[model samples]
Target chain A: MKKRDHKECVSALLPVKDTLDLIGGKWKLLIIISIWEGNKHFREIERSIPKLSTKVLAKELKELEMNKLLHRNVIDDFPVRIEYTLTEHAKSLKTVIGTLHSWGLTHRKAIFEK
Target chain B: MKKRDHKECVSALLPVKDTLDLIGGKWKLLIIISIWEGNKHFREIERSIPKLSTKVLAKELKELEMNKLLHRNVIDDFPVRIEYTLTEHAKSLKTVIGTLHSWGLTHRKAIFEK
Candidate 1:
């Protein structure tokens, strides 16, 4: 098979870069996964991901919200409660995260059993 | 559906963390894709990725080789041609990268056309 040219490689890479730019960091995807798994509050999301501190979680949440991947809702109550949910756009990441989770699981076995 | 507890969440996130630790940087996947596309030599890989500096490419290649995600071969030629290839372990990432590529394409359209 003929090798892809430099131009083809770069074109294929650009969209992946866009995805990474939005959700590449160590904490971003973990937080997304946690929230997707039903950690609706800031503290709950924080506790779900190990070693993710309050400060970093707060920052990541803000970034996710800014990027429209997360929705921050304020519920009306005696004490107003804040909730976080994955936006419709963010739901588009289900397959990406699922694939990563499976690959990660297999990768762990591959690395350890060899 | 029952929400995953913190402990369960942490358990699930650990393998993902393991995978990320191995291949979670900005340029690592891009480099892998380039080599997989038959950019055998270092120069070819370097040229395939846009805006990637020689210094960063060199460093990323070293890390990938050390992680066993890449294999470097020195061909016995007049100039001792050096080549790069993705390892079997790295080939496991095809699904993960494919999912990301498709998600990214959709995401770009979602973000821009909205």
Candidate 2:
């Protein structure tokens, strides 16, 4: 490839690398999807993902918050309920997440049926 | 959520879980994109992705092959050239990868600008 093309390739891929570093894990996207699908409370998120441990979920939640994908809201009612919601930044991931979901279905079918 | 909705949610997420298990790492997608961008040789691929160790690249290549995303070819030449190419199955990841690239750019700007 030409030097200019090579530079463009690297530039395009750097953000991809950054994105993967931020969300590359077994549980992070799953947790994000759960919250996106309305599992706002901790227990609800846990129940939605059948095999994820509470410890892992908690850790991933903190990471997502740090990355600004989601945030914590504490409702200081009589019982002090805390809920998680996707930030607008996180909501922007809907298209990416949706594409993953679609490709994932196709990938699964290709693997299992072949 | 209703019981039916919960079931649909779990079913929708299982393949995503599978997808993540197949490609969730710092290096796999990067390596895939490198090859997709025409860095077919091992060394070329290595050069394209900065800071990626040879051992990790080799491992990720094998894993991607195992998942049917890519394959290895050995050309019959004096020195025996080897090249990696995306399977049609892997090429299907183009949109997914592109979405990731776009979202990653947006994500990087969001975090840095705020």
Best by TM-score: 2
Q: What TM-score would every model get versus the actual structure?
A: 0.86, 0.88
Which residue pairs in candidate 2 have backbone atoms (N, alpha carbon, C) closer than 3 angstroms, thus clashing?
Answer: none
What local distance difference test score does each model get?
0.81, 0.81
CA RMSD, predictions in order: 5.1, 4.5
Candidate 2 regions off by >4 Å? A1-11, B1-11
Candidate 1 docking category?
Answer: medium
**Model 2 C-alpha lDDT per residue in residues B17-52, reported as the tens digit of each score:** 777877787888888888877889999999888899
Residue pairs with backbone overlap in model 1? none
What is the C-alpha lDDT profile of model 1 across A13-92, one tens digit per residue?
Answer: 76777788888888888888788777899889887777889999999999998888989999989699999999988888
* Interface CA root-mean-square deviation for model 2: 1.5
Calculate DockQ per candidate and list them: 0.55, 0.64
C-alpha RMSD of candidate 1: 5.1
TM-score of 1: 0.86
